[model samples]
Target: MTVLKGARERWVRTGGTELCVAELGDPGRPVVVLVHGYPDSKEVWSEVAVRLADRFHVVLYDVRGHGRSSAPRPLRGGFTLEKLTDDFLAVVDAVSPDRPVHLVGHDWGSVQSWEFVTVERTKGRIASFTSMSGPSLDHFGHWINKRLTRPTPRRVGQLLGQGAKSWYVYLLHTPALPELAWRGPLGKRWPAILRRVEDVPGDGYPTSSLPSDAANGAWLYRDNVRTRLRRPRPDAHAHVPVQLITPLGDKFLSERLYDELEQWVPRLTRRTLSAKHWVPRTRPDRIASWITEFVTAVEVTGEPEPRATGRHAERFGGQLVLVTGAGSGIGRATAFAFAEAGARVIAVDRDPESAASTAGTARLIGAPEAWAETVDVSDEREMEKLAAKVHAEYGVLDVLVNNAGVGLSGSFFDTTSDDWRRVLDVNLWGVIHGCRLFGGRMAERGQGGHIVNTASAAAFQPSRVLPAYSTSKAAVLMLSACLRAELAGQGIGVTAICPGLVNTNITATATFVGVDAAEERRRQKRATRAYGLRNYPPEKVADAILRAVARNEAVVPVTPEARGAHALSRFAPRALRALARLQPPV
Candidate 1:
């Protein structure tokens, strides 16, 4: 029995071979056909297929000589790209004879589907293509030829790096030995290898046909790899929209292999995943989401949805990010930044309406999903409840931004104990609660994540007037550093973001301690005016936060003055101290 639970199965015959095809979802809906890779059957797509069944007509078929599909008499020349394309056409024609089908492929399936979409015979049959962990053999050949012809030091290095990753390809091309290995110990240990290295779940996948599948699938590389790479077709450009999903941690393929992919795919949307090569098995939710989005866009508009017009969109798309204090100012900007990069956003604020407003706008921008939560970060019980709710509702966070903080200004002598508690409660203690609860869950999951804490330039360049505020932010800075050291081994990155002054409403709501209410208002106005004169935007700080997470930086000084203060604190402490002691005009 196949692993796909509720599938309607049938057999299609083409060119002396019979393919086992499974259909899920309503037959009248737009069709989505999933093709499996080498050494595996259509069961590879079982998880992804079930997820998309609600919205589309989902189809999965075993390639010739794998799974329940019957093999050719001579496996040597039988698994060529031409034969694979014939098999694909037969399956689609049987499923949907009138309308074109959205095509998705992984590994060797993607390699052959590249031929299906690019060749003239099957051009009208495929409406769109979503490719993962595979490149068109023709494009790859052209890449190699160009690099070898006009070689630079960087190009030479790229060639060498990819060559090293292709060590398995060399081994697969060898005769008889691969079959012997597969029939012997390798076949039995294959499932364990997938579990340990790829983190694939033991769900009775690969079926009981493991040894036969492995032995027959070896011909996939031998039959097509050498022939395609040597005399590649020049007119192999795709006729439909292409979505390329690359796994950054794939041990067998370098990211640079797609450097010149734009020339081959005119309308290309690039996505990247942090997981290993087996994303269909490990990250099925993300894979299914991307495919659904891409297929729907093409169905509606005949092109890919307007691509995310933000920095690092490829790296951040489909990831879940949570931002604290997102009602306004820096927190709101950070949430919108992640949203623009196609991340699903959770906006947390003390105010309900404001958080809801941000989430609504995030969806309008580019986020596929967005939600708002009202919580006072200073309250431990509330934070605990919020963490539990978030984990249950949204799954593990890929990124967490702790940007909630209050501003306070007064002489050290005038700032009393209550003021100290208030400042520390929201700034320092809030960060602590977020990291302890949410971060604990992230670590327990053991998949890797990032945490960002918003400190201030006043942390290092302290001011006498900002005694309580400075103490709280300084504590946050140190806490981020210590936590970064602790979480480094688990692959979680921690960053402390410091900003000198950016134009936001924090100054308006800031407290002027040791003064009358009337005087406090006057001082607040003065401070807001001064910061407004600096004319910095909170969006820039948001960009810095995303960049820090992407690069795994320890400390980031966002503004020019913040960078200067950080440099002076390191190289010239006395000068920074002197500047901190001066009285403000207000």
Candidate 2:
């Protein structure tokens, strides 16, 4: 069965091979040609092609000896990089005769595309190139030569590391052994191996032709790898704009291999993902989104440049970040921080005007896209609806900040049951709702993401006067810990950010339970004034949130007092408990 539904299929004859090509979306639109790696076919890109079909003409073609494509006779000298380039050119000419096509490749496909984009023959035919999980053999050759010529401890270590990773390459090079193994037991267990090792979803992939495909694909390495690396072209610089997406967890390639990539590609945009090698199946949404953004930018400006220029720009750029309570204070500051880092911001708040205002500011702060969402997190239905909308419209959230909350101040005895419920509903349940709805989606996407729960120093320090508030934040801190443990295997990170005495509007809005209306106003004024005197800015907490997500930290204390209290709570609990018994200034 064909993996790509509703795709138009055709054949392109190129240099003693007939390539099986599949086309999706409107042919009149800009063409995006996807080339699959070895031991796979056009079907490897089925998921990504479907996603990209909406915006561009999506094309997937089997390489000369894989899938439905006919293998060349005498496989020993058939699958050279030059032959692959010819096959690529043939497909492009057949599918898009007049327009330059946007090129995307993975694994061995990316290896050949490096040749296509660099060589003078296919320069004008290619518009832009996006490479993932693959490197140019020419570049690899030069990198290996450099380390051999001037061996240092670090360089030698890198070479040894890469050499170890290339163990599979050595196996593939053994004559007739790869073909026998692949066509027999290895083929039967290949799909299971991919599922167990790469976490690739089992969804009608590996096609039934996998055994023959793998056997025929052995010639790819034998024909090209040794010859090209030993005598790499000196002028193998890329002539087109390039976007490189590196999978940090790929076992086959080292991140250091591309350290000198900038010398070959004049215009380069780099993106890294926390994933294994098979991103086409596991991270189709992110891959499609990045491809769309790069293609659109190149189409409009005729160049590829970074959209953001802030700290951690490469990590957060083109990612989606959602911040609750984003109208003001820590929520707003955190949104701006992610915006400056080039994330697409979703500013959500209880107040529509505040959310919209934050979104507007986020756009000005360098967010490629900003949207306002109004929802009360305390209401489960509202949060559920918001999560569905975000998933359906904006794609899975890369980062979620459950920052919306309320404060209730008073002794436990003086605080009414209703008051306790109200505070718990917003402060504790709000975070639970966000985690349940959005966090579930992140896990389901399988691309990994982060969650930042806004707690307080009161969680650990404790105060007699702020009983309800302290309990709610303490629950948040513990909840984050539990989630971090549970989701670690799935690549989701959870962090509880505790801030102390930040100068924000939460102080003025805090309800004074057990006080008269006039007394409540007076208490609010006093609390706000005291916090202002302390003068800790919310932006610092925002910074901590970003850093925590990047580092995948478990629990972060934002302010000086918060850090000290956390330290004390860990080592000197008796002092904290005794301090909790004292009367508060508020």
Candidate 3:
């Protein structure tokens, strides 16, 4: 029985081996062939294949000697690149006989697919290629040669860095050790090790065939590595459009490996994920999305559109980012920032029209896709429903910004219990709800994500005049800190953004306690004018939010005053308290 439910299985005999192949999706749709890496089988692509099965004809085949496939007679020289290419050709010929297939590969699968896409025999057979966690051995050979021949300080350092990363490769080539380890203790412990180190979820992965698969797969390194590195093919240039996805946290590979990749593939698109290796299992949603997008573009326009060149495009492109209170001010600006970086924006606001406007503007700003969601963050049921809807439709969020907030101004004595509840509900509980709902999904996905909570300088600077607002923001700040510590182990980052007096419409909407309607309006106008004079745009705060996520910063103070107040609160509490005690100009 096949491990993938609903999959149609077949066997293709090639190079004296029977390759176990699984096909999913409609047969008439565009064909997408996913190839697995060493010591792994077709099951690695199960998560990704199922996601892509909706729009494309998805196919996954175990490389010879892995999964249910038959092992070569002699382990030595049985898994050469030439034979692997033959296996791929046979599979495609049998499954996608009428048309060329789009190829996606990870790890050693990518290494071999590089050979398939570049070799003259497979030129017209492959329509496009997407590679992750592996570099073409020919390209890798040139990279090594260039650094060795040049011998510059920077080049030497890069060579050493990559050499250190390839420590496992050396072990794989050792005669009997690898096979013994895999058959005895190594294969048994690999699943656990992956869960502990890579945060890869345990869900029927590393199938029972792992011990024999790993032991037999050792011949792949023996047959290819040394010979290719010593004498790489000079004509190793891709014949099809290529998409490269680099995992920033991949322990086994260096990003610098693809520096001169454009020379090998004329048409290229580059994307980076803040993930480790084995993304097929850990980040199936993201992988499926990119693959679908690339394949569709190629099928429609004959080539992918020029990719976004915005700052952090590599990091944010195709990622899903959700921002609450995105109708205006800091929330809207934050949504636009992620859009500019090529993320898919989910603009959530209480006002339906406002949310729609933000989503539309986000699309104009370069988001591949933008959506509007209307929900009152203060309403627990509404937030829960929105969370479920988002997960059902859009998959897990890559970034969540809990920027919805309300402003309140009053002394402790003047502030009503209702006033404090209103402020806390939006400012503090809103963040809590977003973290609990969306952040829980991110944790369960086991792929790391970031959460940004909008706090304020008032959080640390105690102000008698702004008791309700300050207390709410202070609670948010502490909550973010505590959550940061709690989720750090899960690879989730929590950031608190504190902006001082941003020139936005928050002031115009702020409520004033112990004041009549007319006086409240008057105070609101004065506060708006004061903030306008300060002229700290929410755009700057949005930029700070992005930077904080990139750097995984715990707390960020956006404005000069914010920074000053934050420093003073830490180093000179007495001075900060004195300033806070002074009567506000408003």
- Residue pairs that clash (backbone atoms under 3 angstroms), model 2: none
Best-fitting candidate, scored by TM-score? 3
| Candidates by lDDT, descending order | 3, 2, 1
Write out the backbone clash pairs for model 3.
Answer: none
CA displacement after TM-score superposition, residue 475 of candidate 3 (Å): 1.0
* Clash counts for the predictions, in order: 0, 0, 0
lDDT of 2 by residue, 354-411 (tens): 9999999999989999999999999999999999899889988999999998888888
lDDT string, candidate 1, 9-73, tens digits: 99999999999999999999999999999788899999899989999999999899998999998
Q: How does candidate 3 fare on TM-score? A: 0.95
Q: Write the per-residue lDDT of candidate 3 for residues 63-147, one digit (tens) a residue.
A: 9999999989987889999999999999999999989999999999999999999999997799999999989999999999999
Q: Please provide TM-scores, in order, for all candidate models, with all chains considered together.
A: 0.86, 0.94, 0.95
Worst 10 residues of 2 by lDDT: 305-314
Which has the higher TM-score value, candidate number 1 or candidate number 2?
2
- Give the better candidate number (1 or 3) by TM-score: 3
